[model samples]
Target: MTEPLIERCGLRYLHVVGRNFLVWRKLMYASMLGNMADPMIYLVGLGFGLGGFMPAIEGMRYINFLAGGMLCYSAMNSATFEALYSAFSRLKIQRTWEGIMHAPMTAADVVLGEWIWAALKATLSGAAMLIAMYLLGLVHGLRPLAVMPVVLLIGLAFSGLGLIMTALAKSYEFFIFYFTLVITPMMFLSGVFYPRSALPPVVQAIGAVLPLTHGADLARGLTLGTPMAHPLLDVLVLAGYATCGVSVSVLLIRRRLLK
Candidate 1:
Protein backbone atom coordinates (compact mmCIF):
# COMPACT_ATOMS: atom_id res chain seq x y z
CA MET A 1 0.00 0.00 0.00
CA THR A 2 1.06 3.58 -0.55
CA GLU A 3 2.24 5.51 2.47
CA PRO A 4 -0.02 8.00 4.22
CA LEU A 5 -0.17 11.44 2.63
CA ILE A 6 2.17 13.06 5.13
CA GLU A 7 4.54 10.13 5.12
CA ARG A 8 4.69 10.05 1.31
CA CYS A 9 6.53 13.35 0.84
CA GLY A 10 9.30 12.55 3.26
CA LEU A 11 12.97 13.52 3.09
CA ARG A 12 13.41 10.78 0.50
CA TYR A 13 11.90 13.10 -2.07
CA LEU A 14 15.27 14.82 -2.21
CA HIS A 15 16.72 11.67 -3.72
CA VAL A 16 14.42 12.06 -6.71
CA VAL A 17 15.43 15.68 -6.94
CA GLY A 18 19.12 14.72 -6.94
CA ARG A 19 18.54 12.20 -9.70
CA ASN A 20 16.81 14.79 -11.90
CA PHE A 21 19.56 17.29 -11.20
CA LEU A 22 22.23 14.89 -12.45
CA VAL A 23 20.32 14.43 -15.69
CA TRP A 24 19.76 18.16 -16.06
CA ARG A 25 23.37 19.13 -15.35
CA LYS A 26 24.51 17.60 -18.61
CA LEU A 27 22.33 20.04 -20.53
CA MET A 28 22.62 22.95 -18.13
CA TYR A 29 24.39 25.29 -20.53
CA ALA A 30 22.04 24.74 -23.44
CA SER A 31 19.06 24.82 -21.09
CA MET A 32 20.09 28.12 -19.52
CA LEU A 33 20.77 29.60 -22.93
CA GLY A 34 17.31 28.69 -24.19
CA ASN A 35 15.59 29.85 -21.01
CA MET A 36 17.32 33.21 -21.00
CA ALA A 37 16.50 34.16 -24.58
CA ASP A 38 12.81 35.08 -24.47
CA PRO A 39 12.87 37.04 -21.24
CA MET A 40 15.95 38.94 -22.35
CA ILE A 41 14.15 39.94 -25.51
CA TYR A 42 11.13 41.06 -23.56
CA LEU A 43 13.32 42.98 -21.15
CA VAL A 44 15.20 44.81 -23.87
CA GLY A 45 12.75 44.90 -26.72
CA LEU A 46 9.64 45.85 -24.80
CA GLY A 47 11.33 47.60 -21.93
CA PHE A 48 13.05 50.05 -24.24
CA GLY A 49 11.14 49.90 -27.47
CA LEU A 50 7.72 50.21 -25.88
CA GLY A 51 8.73 51.76 -22.59
CA GLY A 52 9.97 54.84 -24.38
CA PHE A 53 6.44 55.65 -25.43
CA MET A 54 4.85 54.96 -22.08
CA PRO A 55 4.99 57.55 -19.35
CA ALA A 56 6.17 56.92 -15.82
CA ILE A 57 4.00 54.40 -13.99
CA GLU A 58 3.30 55.22 -10.37
CA GLY A 59 6.33 57.51 -10.38
CA MET A 60 8.78 54.92 -11.80
CA ARG A 61 10.06 54.55 -15.33
CA TYR A 62 8.02 52.16 -17.41
CA ILE A 63 11.01 49.86 -17.77
CA ASN A 64 11.44 49.66 -14.00
CA PHE A 65 7.77 48.90 -13.64
CA LEU A 66 7.89 46.21 -16.30
CA ALA A 67 11.00 44.58 -14.84
CA GLY A 68 9.17 43.53 -11.69
CA GLY A 69 6.36 41.89 -13.59
CA MET A 70 8.89 40.23 -15.93
CA LEU A 71 10.67 38.71 -12.94
CA CYS A 72 7.49 37.04 -11.73
CA TYR A 73 6.57 36.08 -15.29
CA SER A 74 9.97 34.50 -15.91
CA ALA A 75 9.72 32.47 -12.74
CA MET A 76 6.21 31.35 -13.57
CA ASN A 77 7.07 30.24 -17.10
CA SER A 78 10.21 28.41 -15.99
CA ALA A 79 8.38 26.44 -13.33
CA THR A 80 5.47 25.63 -15.61
CA PHE A 81 7.72 24.47 -18.47
CA GLU A 82 9.77 22.24 -16.20
CA ALA A 83 6.78 20.78 -14.38
CA LEU A 84 4.79 20.11 -17.52
CA TYR A 85 7.30 19.11 -20.21
CA SER A 86 10.10 17.58 -18.19
CA ALA A 87 7.81 15.91 -15.67
CA PHE A 88 5.63 14.51 -18.42
CA SER A 89 8.68 13.00 -20.13
CA ARG A 90 9.63 11.27 -16.92
CA LEU A 91 6.05 10.27 -16.25
CA LYS A 92 5.11 8.92 -19.67
CA ILE A 93 7.66 9.12 -22.49
CA GLN A 94 10.71 7.84 -20.61
CA ARG A 95 9.14 5.91 -17.73
CA THR A 96 11.62 7.49 -15.35
CA TRP A 97 8.98 7.73 -12.70
CA GLU A 98 8.49 4.00 -12.87
CA GLY A 99 12.17 3.39 -12.29
CA ILE A 100 12.10 5.82 -9.40
CA MET A 101 9.04 4.10 -8.01
CA HIS A 102 11.00 0.85 -7.95
CA ALA A 103 13.68 2.75 -6.09
CA PRO A 104 11.34 2.04 -3.16
CA MET A 105 9.41 5.31 -3.13
CA THR A 106 5.82 6.52 -3.33
CA ALA A 107 4.27 8.47 -6.21
CA ALA A 108 4.04 11.44 -3.90
CA ASP A 109 7.81 11.36 -3.53
CA VAL A 110 8.29 11.73 -7.26
CA VAL A 111 5.62 14.40 -7.56
CA LEU A 112 6.99 16.44 -4.71
CA GLY A 113 10.51 16.13 -6.01
CA GLU A 114 9.45 17.38 -9.43
CA TRP A 115 7.47 20.12 -7.75
CA ILE A 116 10.47 21.36 -5.75
CA TRP A 117 12.86 20.91 -8.65
CA ALA A 118 10.72 22.97 -10.97
CA ALA A 119 10.59 25.69 -8.36
CA LEU A 120 14.35 25.53 -7.85
CA LYS A 121 15.06 25.67 -11.56
CA ALA A 122 12.63 28.53 -12.01
CA THR A 123 14.68 30.68 -9.66
CA LEU A 124 17.46 30.52 -12.22
CA SER A 125 15.14 32.09 -14.77
CA GLY A 126 14.03 34.69 -12.31
CA ALA A 127 17.65 35.37 -11.39
CA ALA A 128 18.57 35.84 -15.02
CA MET A 129 15.93 38.54 -15.42
CA LEU A 130 16.98 40.18 -12.18
CA ILE A 131 20.62 40.24 -13.22
CA ALA A 132 19.64 41.71 -16.56
CA MET A 133 17.65 44.37 -14.80
CA TYR A 134 20.70 45.12 -12.66
CA LEU A 135 23.09 45.31 -15.61
CA LEU A 136 20.69 47.58 -17.47
CA GLY A 137 20.64 49.87 -14.42
CA LEU A 138 16.96 49.26 -13.82
CA VAL A 139 17.41 48.02 -10.23
CA HIS A 140 19.40 49.73 -7.52
CA GLY A 141 20.69 49.33 -3.98
CA LEU A 142 20.05 46.18 -1.93
CA ARG A 143 16.42 45.94 -2.95
CA PRO A 144 17.04 43.44 -5.77
CA LEU A 145 18.37 40.89 -3.28
CA ALA A 146 14.92 40.88 -1.72
CA VAL A 147 13.45 39.72 -5.03
CA MET A 148 14.93 36.17 -4.87
CA PRO A 149 12.54 34.91 -2.23
CA VAL A 150 9.64 36.27 -4.27
CA VAL A 151 11.04 34.46 -7.30
CA LEU A 152 11.15 31.16 -5.44
CA LEU A 153 7.61 31.61 -4.23
CA ILE A 154 6.44 32.37 -7.76
CA GLY A 155 8.21 29.20 -8.90
CA LEU A 156 6.51 27.09 -6.26
CA ALA A 157 3.13 28.52 -7.11
CA PHE A 158 3.40 27.86 -10.85
CA SER A 159 5.15 24.50 -10.44
CA GLY A 160 2.30 23.19 -8.34
CA LEU A 161 -0.28 24.42 -10.81
CA GLY A 162 1.67 22.99 -13.74
CA LEU A 163 1.93 19.58 -12.07
CA ILE A 164 -1.80 19.56 -11.68
CA MET A 165 -2.03 20.04 -15.44
CA THR A 166 0.63 17.40 -16.08
CA ALA A 167 -1.21 14.86 -13.97
CA LEU A 168 -4.23 15.18 -16.21
CA ALA A 169 -2.62 15.52 -19.63
CA LYS A 170 -3.19 12.53 -21.93
CA SER A 171 -0.65 13.58 -24.59
CA TYR A 172 1.98 16.19 -25.24
CA GLU A 173 -0.42 18.09 -27.45
CA PHE A 174 -2.80 18.54 -24.52
CA PHE A 175 -0.36 21.07 -23.10
CA ILE A 176 -0.99 23.50 -25.94
CA PHE A 177 -4.46 24.33 -24.69
CA TYR A 178 -3.11 25.16 -21.25
CA PHE A 179 -0.39 27.48 -22.49
CA THR A 180 -2.66 29.24 -24.93
CA LEU A 181 -5.71 29.43 -22.70
CA VAL A 182 -4.21 29.81 -19.27
CA ILE A 183 -0.63 31.11 -19.36
CA THR A 184 -1.14 33.51 -22.24
CA PRO A 185 -4.20 35.14 -20.75
CA MET A 186 -2.53 35.20 -17.35
CA MET A 187 0.51 36.95 -18.78
CA PHE A 188 -1.68 39.70 -20.13
CA LEU A 189 -3.96 39.99 -17.13
CA SER A 190 -1.31 39.71 -14.42
CA GLY A 191 0.33 42.99 -15.39
CA VAL A 192 3.52 41.63 -16.89
CA PHE A 193 3.66 44.06 -19.78
CA TYR A 194 1.58 46.80 -18.20
CA PRO A 195 -0.19 47.70 -15.02
CA ARG A 196 -3.45 45.96 -14.32
CA SER A 197 -4.87 49.30 -13.27
CA ALA A 198 -5.22 50.25 -16.92
CA LEU A 199 -7.42 47.25 -17.68
CA PRO A 200 -11.18 47.28 -17.53
CA PRO A 201 -12.73 46.89 -14.11
CA VAL A 202 -14.11 43.45 -14.90
CA VAL A 203 -10.78 42.23 -16.15
CA GLN A 204 -9.13 43.68 -13.08
CA ALA A 205 -11.41 41.69 -10.82
CA ILE A 206 -10.54 38.43 -12.54
CA GLY A 207 -6.82 39.15 -12.56
CA ALA A 208 -6.84 39.83 -8.85
CA VAL A 209 -7.63 36.19 -8.15
CA LEU A 210 -4.75 34.80 -10.19
CA PRO A 211 -1.54 33.71 -8.42
CA LEU A 212 0.56 35.73 -10.87
CA THR A 213 -1.27 38.88 -9.85
CA HIS A 214 -0.16 38.61 -6.26
CA GLY A 215 3.31 37.43 -7.29
CA ALA A 216 3.71 40.34 -9.68
CA ASP A 217 2.62 42.79 -7.05
CA LEU A 218 5.11 41.35 -4.59
CA ALA A 219 7.97 41.25 -7.07
CA ARG A 220 7.21 44.71 -8.40
CA GLY A 221 7.04 46.10 -4.92
CA LEU A 222 10.35 44.56 -3.96
CA THR A 223 12.14 45.52 -7.17
CA LEU A 224 10.98 49.12 -7.08
CA GLY A 225 11.44 49.49 -3.32
CA THR A 226 7.79 50.30 -2.86
CA PRO A 227 5.46 49.14 -0.12
CA MET A 228 3.34 46.08 -0.81
CA ALA A 229 -0.29 46.86 -0.16
CA HIS A 230 -0.84 43.64 1.74
CA PRO A 231 2.38 41.72 1.85
CA LEU A 232 1.06 39.11 4.27
CA LEU A 233 -2.18 38.60 2.41
CA ASP A 234 -0.48 38.31 -0.98
CA VAL A 235 1.97 35.75 0.38
CA LEU A 236 -0.82 33.80 2.00
CA VAL A 237 -2.67 33.69 -1.32
CA LEU A 238 0.37 32.33 -3.18
CA ALA A 239 1.16 29.82 -0.44
CA GLY A 240 -2.44 28.71 -0.55
CA TYR A 241 -2.21 28.06 -4.28
CA ALA A 242 0.99 26.07 -3.87
CA THR A 243 -0.44 24.05 -1.00
CA CYS A 244 -3.69 23.19 -2.73
CA GLY A 245 -2.11 22.55 -6.13
CA VAL A 246 0.49 20.12 -4.78
CA SER A 247 -2.01 18.36 -2.55
CA VAL A 248 -4.49 17.87 -5.37
CA SER A 249 -1.77 16.88 -7.87
CA VAL A 250 -0.42 14.26 -5.49
CA LEU A 251 -3.83 12.68 -5.24
CA LEU A 252 -4.41 12.81 -9.00
CA ILE A 253 -0.97 11.51 -10.03
CA ARG A 254 -1.11 8.68 -7.50
CA ARG A 255 -4.37 7.51 -8.98
CA ARG A 256 -3.05 7.94 -12.53
CA LEU A 257 0.06 5.81 -11.95
CA LEU A 258 -1.40 2.57 -10.69
CA LYS A 259 1.16 0.02 -9.59
Candidate 2:
Protein backbone atom coordinates (compact mmCIF):
# COMPACT_ATOMS: atom_id res chain seq x y z
CA MET A 1 0.00 0.00 0.00
CA THR A 2 2.75 2.40 0.97
CA GLU A 3 4.71 1.67 -2.20
CA PRO A 4 1.67 2.23 -4.39
CA LEU A 5 0.87 5.45 -2.56
CA ILE A 6 4.40 6.70 -3.07
CA GLU A 7 4.30 5.79 -6.73
CA ARG A 8 1.03 7.65 -7.13
CA CYS A 9 2.52 10.72 -5.54
CA GLY A 10 5.57 10.54 -7.79
CA LEU A 11 3.38 10.24 -10.85
CA ARG A 12 1.36 13.28 -9.84
CA TYR A 13 4.48 15.37 -9.38
CA LEU A 14 5.88 14.20 -12.69
CA HIS A 15 2.65 15.12 -14.39
CA VAL A 16 3.09 18.70 -13.27
CA VAL A 17 6.69 18.71 -14.42
CA GLY A 18 5.71 17.31 -17.83
CA ARG A 19 3.16 20.06 -18.34
CA ASN A 20 5.73 22.73 -17.50
CA PHE A 21 8.31 21.08 -19.72
CA LEU A 22 5.96 21.20 -22.67
CA VAL A 23 5.39 24.91 -22.18
CA TRP A 24 9.09 25.57 -21.74
CA ARG A 25 10.01 23.65 -24.86
CA LYS A 26 7.80 25.84 -26.98
CA LEU A 27 9.74 28.91 -25.86
CA MET A 28 13.13 27.27 -25.51
CA TYR A 29 15.07 29.90 -27.36
CA ALA A 30 13.61 32.83 -25.48
CA SER A 31 14.11 31.01 -22.18
CA MET A 32 17.72 30.29 -23.01
CA LEU A 33 18.33 33.86 -24.10
CA GLY A 34 16.69 35.29 -20.98
CA ASN A 35 18.63 32.99 -18.70
CA MET A 36 22.04 33.62 -20.32
CA ALA A 37 21.86 37.30 -21.11
CA ASP A 38 22.00 39.16 -17.78
CA PRO A 39 24.76 37.12 -16.22
CA MET A 40 26.89 37.38 -19.35
CA ILE A 41 26.38 41.12 -19.45
CA TYR A 42 27.36 41.50 -15.80
CA LEU A 43 30.38 39.26 -16.23
CA VAL A 44 31.66 41.04 -19.30
CA GLY A 45 30.58 44.59 -18.59
CA LEU A 46 31.37 44.90 -14.91
CA GLY A 47 34.15 42.33 -14.88
CA PHE A 48 36.01 44.12 -17.65
CA GLY A 49 34.92 47.70 -17.14
CA LEU A 50 35.32 47.89 -13.38
CA GLY A 51 38.04 45.26 -13.29
CA GLY A 52 40.33 47.35 -15.48
CA PHE A 53 40.39 50.08 -12.85
CA MET A 54 40.75 47.78 -9.85
CA PRO A 55 43.48 45.54 -8.53
CA ALA A 56 43.19 41.78 -8.13
CA ILE A 57 40.96 40.69 -5.27
CA GLU A 58 41.84 37.79 -3.00
CA GLY A 59 44.71 36.87 -5.39
CA MET A 60 42.51 36.55 -8.52
CA ARG A 61 41.49 38.92 -11.29
CA TYR A 62 38.29 40.90 -10.64
CA ILE A 63 36.46 39.01 -13.38
CA ASN A 64 37.36 35.71 -11.78
CA PHE A 65 36.12 36.91 -8.43
CA LEU A 66 32.88 38.08 -10.01
CA ALA A 67 32.32 34.82 -11.87
CA GLY A 68 31.68 32.68 -8.79
CA GLY A 69 29.27 35.19 -7.29
CA MET A 70 27.46 35.42 -10.63
CA LEU A 71 26.90 31.64 -10.65
CA CYS A 72 25.07 31.72 -7.34
CA TYR A 73 23.26 34.95 -8.18
CA SER A 74 22.05 33.62 -11.50
CA ALA A 75 20.51 30.60 -9.82
CA MET A 76 18.86 32.77 -7.21
CA ASN A 77 17.45 35.30 -9.69
CA SER A 78 16.11 32.58 -12.00
CA ALA A 79 14.41 30.71 -9.19
CA THR A 80 12.94 33.86 -7.74
CA PHE A 81 11.52 34.97 -11.07
CA GLU A 82 9.97 31.61 -11.81
CA ALA A 83 8.50 31.23 -8.34
CA LEU A 84 7.18 34.77 -8.15
CA TYR A 85 6.16 35.79 -11.65
CA SER A 86 5.62 32.49 -13.43
CA ALA A 87 4.06 30.72 -10.50
CA PHE A 88 1.81 33.64 -9.75
CA SER A 89 0.65 33.77 -13.35
CA ARG A 90 -0.30 30.13 -13.32
CA LEU A 91 -1.95 30.35 -9.92
CA LYS A 92 -3.89 33.58 -10.32
CA ILE A 93 -3.86 34.92 -13.85
CA GLN A 94 -4.02 31.80 -15.98
CA ARG A 95 -6.03 29.74 -13.47
CA THR A 96 -3.72 26.79 -14.04
CA TRP A 97 -3.59 25.85 -10.40
CA GLU A 98 -7.38 25.81 -10.16
CA GLY A 99 -7.58 23.50 -13.12
CA ILE A 100 -4.91 21.18 -11.73
CA MET A 101 -6.50 20.97 -8.30
CA HIS A 102 -9.69 19.71 -9.90
CA ALA A 103 -7.73 16.56 -10.69
CA PRO A 104 -6.64 13.95 -8.11
CA MET A 105 -3.74 16.17 -7.03
CA THR A 106 -4.01 18.37 -3.95
CA ALA A 107 -2.66 21.88 -3.48
CA ALA A 108 0.37 20.42 -1.72
CA ASP A 109 1.25 18.41 -4.80
CA VAL A 110 0.92 21.42 -7.03
CA VAL A 111 3.06 23.63 -4.83
CA LEU A 112 5.72 20.98 -4.36
CA GLY A 113 5.82 20.30 -8.08
CA GLU A 114 6.11 24.00 -8.85
CA TRP A 115 8.94 24.35 -6.35
CA ILE A 116 10.84 21.48 -7.96
CA TRP A 117 10.28 22.84 -11.46
CA ALA A 118 11.51 26.31 -10.48
CA ALA A 119 14.65 24.87 -8.95
CA LEU A 120 15.39 22.87 -12.08
CA LYS A 121 14.93 25.92 -14.27
CA ALA A 122 17.18 27.96 -12.02
CA THR A 123 19.88 25.30 -12.23
CA LEU A 124 19.93 25.69 -16.00
CA SER A 125 20.62 29.41 -15.65
CA GLY A 126 23.42 28.80 -13.18
CA ALA A 127 24.94 26.07 -15.34
CA ALA A 128 24.93 28.36 -18.35
CA MET A 129 26.71 31.08 -16.39
CA LEU A 130 29.25 28.57 -15.09
CA ILE A 131 29.99 27.33 -18.60
CA ALA A 132 30.27 30.84 -19.96
CA MET A 133 32.73 31.67 -17.21
CA TYR A 134 34.73 28.56 -18.01
CA LEU A 135 34.98 29.41 -21.69
CA LEU A 136 36.04 32.93 -20.86
CA GLY A 137 38.92 31.68 -18.67
CA LEU A 138 37.32 32.88 -15.44
CA VAL A 139 36.98 29.34 -14.05
CA HIS A 140 39.89 27.04 -13.18
CA GLY A 141 40.24 23.39 -12.20
CA LEU A 142 37.66 20.56 -12.27
CA ARG A 143 36.63 21.50 -8.74
CA PRO A 144 34.46 24.26 -10.18
CA LEU A 145 32.02 21.66 -11.48
CA ALA A 146 31.20 20.87 -7.86
CA VAL A 147 29.47 24.21 -7.70
CA MET A 148 26.50 22.70 -9.61
CA PRO A 149 24.92 21.11 -6.54
CA VAL A 150 25.45 24.26 -4.55
CA VAL A 151 23.76 26.20 -7.35
CA LEU A 152 20.74 23.90 -7.09
CA LEU A 153 20.66 24.43 -3.35
CA ILE A 154 20.66 28.16 -3.95
CA GLY A 155 17.81 27.72 -6.41
CA LEU A 156 15.75 25.64 -3.99
CA ALA A 157 16.34 28.11 -1.20
CA PHE A 158 15.27 31.12 -3.23
CA SER A 159 12.38 29.32 -4.90
CA GLY A 160 10.90 28.42 -1.58
CA LEU A 161 11.08 32.00 -0.42
CA GLY A 162 9.64 33.23 -3.68
CA LEU A 163 6.68 30.88 -3.24
CA ILE A 164 5.94 32.40 0.12
CA MET A 165 5.78 35.80 -1.51
CA THR A 166 3.61 34.43 -4.27
CA ALA A 167 1.20 33.04 -1.74
CA LEU A 168 0.75 36.46 -0.21
CA ALA A 169 0.58 38.24 -3.51
CA LYS A 170 -2.79 39.56 -4.70
CA SER A 171 -1.53 41.28 -7.82
CA TYR A 172 1.59 41.29 -9.92
CA GLU A 173 2.49 44.65 -8.42
CA PHE A 174 2.96 43.01 -5.02
CA PHE A 175 6.18 41.46 -6.25
CA ILE A 176 7.66 44.89 -6.81
CA PHE A 177 7.69 45.44 -3.07
CA TYR A 178 9.36 42.10 -2.46
CA PHE A 179 12.00 42.81 -5.08
CA THR A 180 12.67 46.33 -3.88
CA LEU A 181 12.68 45.53 -0.17
CA VAL A 182 14.08 42.03 -0.13
CA ILE A 183 15.69 40.80 -3.36
CA THR A 184 17.50 44.00 -4.28
CA PRO A 185 18.96 44.44 -0.80
CA MET A 186 19.98 40.78 -0.69
CA MET A 187 21.77 41.10 -4.05
CA PHE A 188 24.00 43.80 -2.64
CA LEU A 189 24.34 42.57 0.94
CA SER A 190 24.93 38.88 0.18
CA GLY A 191 28.49 39.40 -1.12
CA VAL A 192 27.64 39.10 -4.79
CA PHE A 193 29.50 42.23 -5.84
CA TYR A 194 32.08 42.15 -3.04
CA PRO A 195 33.20 40.29 0.07
CA ARG A 196 30.98 40.37 3.14
CA SER A 197 34.06 40.97 5.28
CA ALA A 198 34.43 44.37 3.66
CA LEU A 199 30.98 45.44 4.87
CA PRO A 200 30.44 47.24 8.15
CA PRO A 201 30.08 45.04 11.23
CA VAL A 202 26.31 45.47 11.48
CA VAL A 203 25.74 44.78 7.79
CA GLN A 204 28.03 41.77 7.99
CA ALA A 205 25.96 40.43 10.85
CA ILE A 206 22.83 40.86 8.73
CA GLY A 207 24.51 39.22 5.76
CA ALA A 208 25.42 36.27 7.93
CA VAL A 209 21.72 35.55 8.39
CA LEU A 210 20.75 35.80 4.73
CA PRO A 211 20.45 32.59 2.61
CA LEU A 212 22.16 34.23 -0.36
CA THR A 213 25.23 34.98 1.77
CA HIS A 214 25.71 31.30 2.52
CA GLY A 215 25.12 30.38 -1.13
CA ALA A 216 27.54 32.97 -2.45
CA ASP A 217 30.16 31.84 0.06
CA LEU A 218 29.82 28.18 -0.94
CA ALA A 219 29.81 28.89 -4.68
CA ARG A 220 32.81 31.21 -4.43
CA GLY A 221 34.75 28.83 -2.24
CA LEU A 222 34.12 25.86 -4.51
CA THR A 223 34.77 27.70 -7.76
CA LEU A 224 37.87 29.55 -6.55
CA GLY A 225 39.38 26.67 -4.53
CA THR A 226 39.30 28.76 -1.39
CA PRO A 227 38.82 27.25 2.06
CA MET A 228 35.38 27.87 3.53
CA ALA A 229 35.45 29.07 7.11
CA HIS A 230 32.38 26.99 7.94
CA PRO A 231 31.28 24.84 5.04
CA LEU A 232 28.92 22.70 7.12
CA LEU A 233 27.21 25.73 8.57
CA ASP A 234 26.66 27.20 5.12
CA VAL A 235 24.98 24.04 3.88
CA LEU A 236 22.84 23.81 6.98
CA VAL A 237 21.68 27.40 6.62
CA LEU A 238 20.60 26.95 3.03
CA ALA A 239 18.93 23.66 3.89
CA GLY A 240 17.07 25.28 6.74
CA TYR A 241 15.76 27.99 4.45
CA ALA A 242 14.69 25.49 1.80
CA THR A 243 12.90 23.31 4.33
CA CYS A 244 11.06 26.08 6.13
CA GLY A 245 10.22 27.95 2.98
CA VAL A 246 8.63 24.87 1.42
CA SER A 247 6.61 24.13 4.53
CA VAL A 248 5.30 27.66 4.90
CA SER A 249 4.62 27.99 1.21
CA VAL A 250 2.53 24.82 1.19
CA LEU A 251 0.43 26.00 4.11
CA LEU A 252 -0.12 29.46 2.68
CA ILE A 253 -0.87 28.28 -0.82
CA ARG A 254 -3.24 25.60 0.47
CA ARG A 255 -5.13 28.16 2.49
CA ARG A 256 -5.38 30.53 -0.46
CA LEU A 257 -6.55 27.85 -2.83
CA LEU A 258 -9.13 26.47 -0.42
CA LYS A 259 -10.55 29.93 0.04
Identify the leading candidate in terms of TM-score. 1
- Model 1, 77-186: lDDT tens digits are 99999999999999999999988888778888889999999999999999998889889998888867897987888899899999999999998999999999999999
TM-score of each: 0.97, 0.95
Scored against the true structure, residue 8 in model 1 reaches a CA lDDT of: 37
Reference-based lDDT, residue 52, model 1: 91
Provide the lDDT at 239 for model 2.
93
Cα lDDT of model 2 by residue, 47-156, tens digit: 99998998888888888888888888889999999999999999999999999989877788888889889999989999999899888987777989998998888889
Clashes of each: 0, 0
lDDT accuracy of residue 45 in candidate 1: 91
lDDT score of residue 115 within candidate 1: 94
